[model samples]
Target: MFFAGTVKTMLPKVPSTSGKMDIIRPLAYVREKDIINFMKHNEIQAMSCGCPIEAGKVDSKRKEIKILLQELETKNPNIKQSIFNAMKNINLDYVLGYTSGNKSKG
Candidate 1:
C-alpha cells in the first residue's frame, strides 16, 4: 500500500496470503513522512493502533474505544488507570521466561 497526497493508494491487484502467512502482504512502499504529512494536511483525526479485537465498521472502531474508556472511567475515577487501559496491550505469548502461573503454582 502507498500514500498519495492525503490519500492511501493501494495497487489494483489481489493481495497475497500464501505459504505460512495468514494476512496478505502489501507490496508498495509508502514513506512514513508522507503518510504523516498527508494525515496532518488533511486534518485526519486518529490513527488505529491496529488491534485484533477491533470489530464492526471502520468508523465504529473509534466509537467503541471511546465507549470503553468512558465505561472504565465511570467504574474507576483514576486517570492513571484510564490511560493505562487505553494503551495497546503487549502480547506476552512470545516473551521468553514469561509464565502464567501464580505464586502458589511455583
Candidate 2:
C-alpha cells in the first residue's frame, strides 16, 4: 500500500495487518487481506465504547458497529463473546488492548 503527496493528493492501497503501507503489497504480504477491514474494526470498537444496546442495533451513536458485530458473530461462534462484551465494556484501555495483539480478549 502507498500514499503519496498530501492526504488530499494521495491515492493509496490497503495496508498490511501491521498498518504499514507499501508500494506494491502482494497478496502474500497482506496478512489481513485488506486494510479497510482494520479501519472498520477500529471504528466498531470505538463505537462499542460509546453506545447503549437497543433493538437490533445500538441506540446511541453508531449502528454499523452493532450490525457488523452481529453478522460476524453469526458466522463465527468463537467471536461471539467479543462483541457481546464490547457492548457492556466501559473502558477504552481494555478495548484498545483487545484490538491490538492479544487474541483472547476479543
Candidate 3:
C-alpha cells in the first residue's frame, strides 16, 4: 500500500504489533509521486521481506555519499575514484546482516 502525507500523518501513532512485516521507510523524505515514479522506473511489483528496506537504505546512503563525493571532487578530482574503490571493499551482506540482527535485538 502507498501512503502519502507528512511524517506525523504517515507514521503509526502507536507501535506496530505486526512482526517482521515488509515495509520500506525512506531515510530521506520523498514525495509520493517521486516514489511512484521510482517504482515505475524500476519495474517493481511488490516488496517482500526486508530486502526492499535494506536496498532503499543503501540507495539513499549512496545518493548522500555521491553528493559528499562531488563536493570533495572539487578539492581533489581523484578522490571520487578512491572512494568508489574503497566502497567496493564493503561487505554488504555483513553490513545488512548486522543491521537486521541489531533490529531483532531491539
Candidate 4:
C-alpha cells in the first residue's frame, strides 16, 4: 500500500473537471473596403510610402515615415491599396515642398 501510494504521488495531477477551455481575445480584423476608405480619407496611396532608410547620414524623418508605413503593411496585409496610396501622397508632398534653397510652406 505504501509503494502504491508513493507511485500515485509521483504521477502528475490533473483537474477532474471537464468543459474548461481556453479563450483567446482576438483583434478586430479590418476589411479591404474599409482600408480603401481610410486611404481616401487620409489623402494617401493605400499602400504608398516615400521614405527609405539607408546608412550614412540617413534622414530620421524619412526613416520614421518608412517605419510607419512598414508597420501598417505588416499589421494588415489586406490594406495594400492604402499602403500604395500613402506612398503616392508622400511623393506628392515631397514634390510640392522640395526646392533648392527654398522652404516651401505646408
Candidate 5:
C-alpha cells in the first residue's frame, strides 16, 4: 500500500502501532515513475508525505529509513511479522480519505 497526496502540515508524531514503517519524502519534483523505482529499490510499502516535505528531505529520509530498517533487524528478529501485522491491522474507519461503495442512504 502506497500513499501519496497533499498533507497540509508536517506529520503528527503518532506512536508506532507495529513495526517501523518507512516514510519517504522525495526532495524535488521528480517523475512519478522514477519515484516508484526508488520506492521499489528501498522496499517502501507505505508513505506519508507530499510536495512540502519533498522539497528538501529526500536523501535524508532515504538514509534514515535504511538505518531504521537495520536497527529493527538488529533489535527484533520478527520484523517481517511485525510489518505484516501493521499492514493487516489497518482500520478503514479511521482512514481520512477512505470511502466505501456501501454508503448509507440519507
Candidate 6:
C-alpha cells in the first residue's frame, strides 16, 4: 500500500489486526512534498488490489450505521438501556472473522 498525501489528508488511520503480518503492507509512506520522488521511485504496475476502495466503502457504511443508531436513540430515548444491553451481548468477532488470532473458530 502506498499512502501518498499530506499528514492532514482525510486518509483513514491504519487498523490493527491480530495477524502475524499486516493485512495492508505499506510499500511507501509518501508525503505531499515528496510526491515527485515517490512517483519516480515506484513502478506503475497494477495487479488486483481492491482493499483501499473496499475499506472506504466499509468506512462509509459504518458512518451511516452510526447515524442511524444516533437517530434511533434520539427517537426512542427510553430504550437506551435496552439498546446498550443488546449491543453488549452481541459478539462480532467470529462473524467478522477476527476471532482467535484473526481466524474464525465458528
**Candidates' lDDT values, in order?**
0.50, 0.47, 0.54, 0.50, 0.57, 0.50
Candidate with more favorable, higher lDDT: 1 or 5? 5
- Writing each residue's lDDT as its tens digit, candidate 5 over 1-106 gives 3234522322334335464864544543354557789989999875666755455455566456556767997889777568656655766566666434576322
* N/CA/C clash count, model 2: 1
Tens-place lDDT digits, model 3, residues 1-106: 0133211223323345685464555533464457888889999775655766456655665466557877997999888567445544765555423233246321
RMSD of each: 14.2, 19.1, 14.3, 28.0, 14.4, 15.1
Kindly report which residue pairs in candidate 1 clash with one another. Answer: none
Q: Write the per-residue lDDT of candidate 2 for residues 12-98, one digit (tens) a residue.
A: 354565876554434433423255588686774323434245443545433565566568867886574564455556575644333
**What TM-score would each prediction reach against the true structure?**
0.24, 0.21, 0.25, 0.24, 0.30, 0.26
Number of colliding residue pairs in each model: 0, 1, 0, 21, 0, 0
The regions of model 3 sitting more than 4 angstroms off are 1-59, 84-106
Task: Say what the RMSD of model 5 is.
Answer: 14.4
Q: Which lDDT value does model 1 have at 26? A: 57
User: What lDDT score goes with residue 25 in model 5?
Assistant: 49
Ranked by lDDT, the better of candidates 5 and 6 is 5
| Candidate 3 steric clashes | 0
Instruction: Choose 2 or 4, whichever is better by TM-score.
Output: 4
By TM-score, the best candidate is 5
Where is model 6 more than 4 Å wrong at Cα? 1-59, 78-80, 88-106
The deviation in Å at residue 89 for candidate 3 is 10
Clashing pairs in 5: none
List residue ranges in candidate 4 displaced over 4 A: 1-53, 78-80, 83-106
Off by over 4 Å in 1: 1-15, 18-27, 52-106
Q: Write the per-residue lDDT of candidate 4 for residues 10-75, one digit (tens) a residue.
A: 113333447375333232245446777887998876443453535425567546755676688787
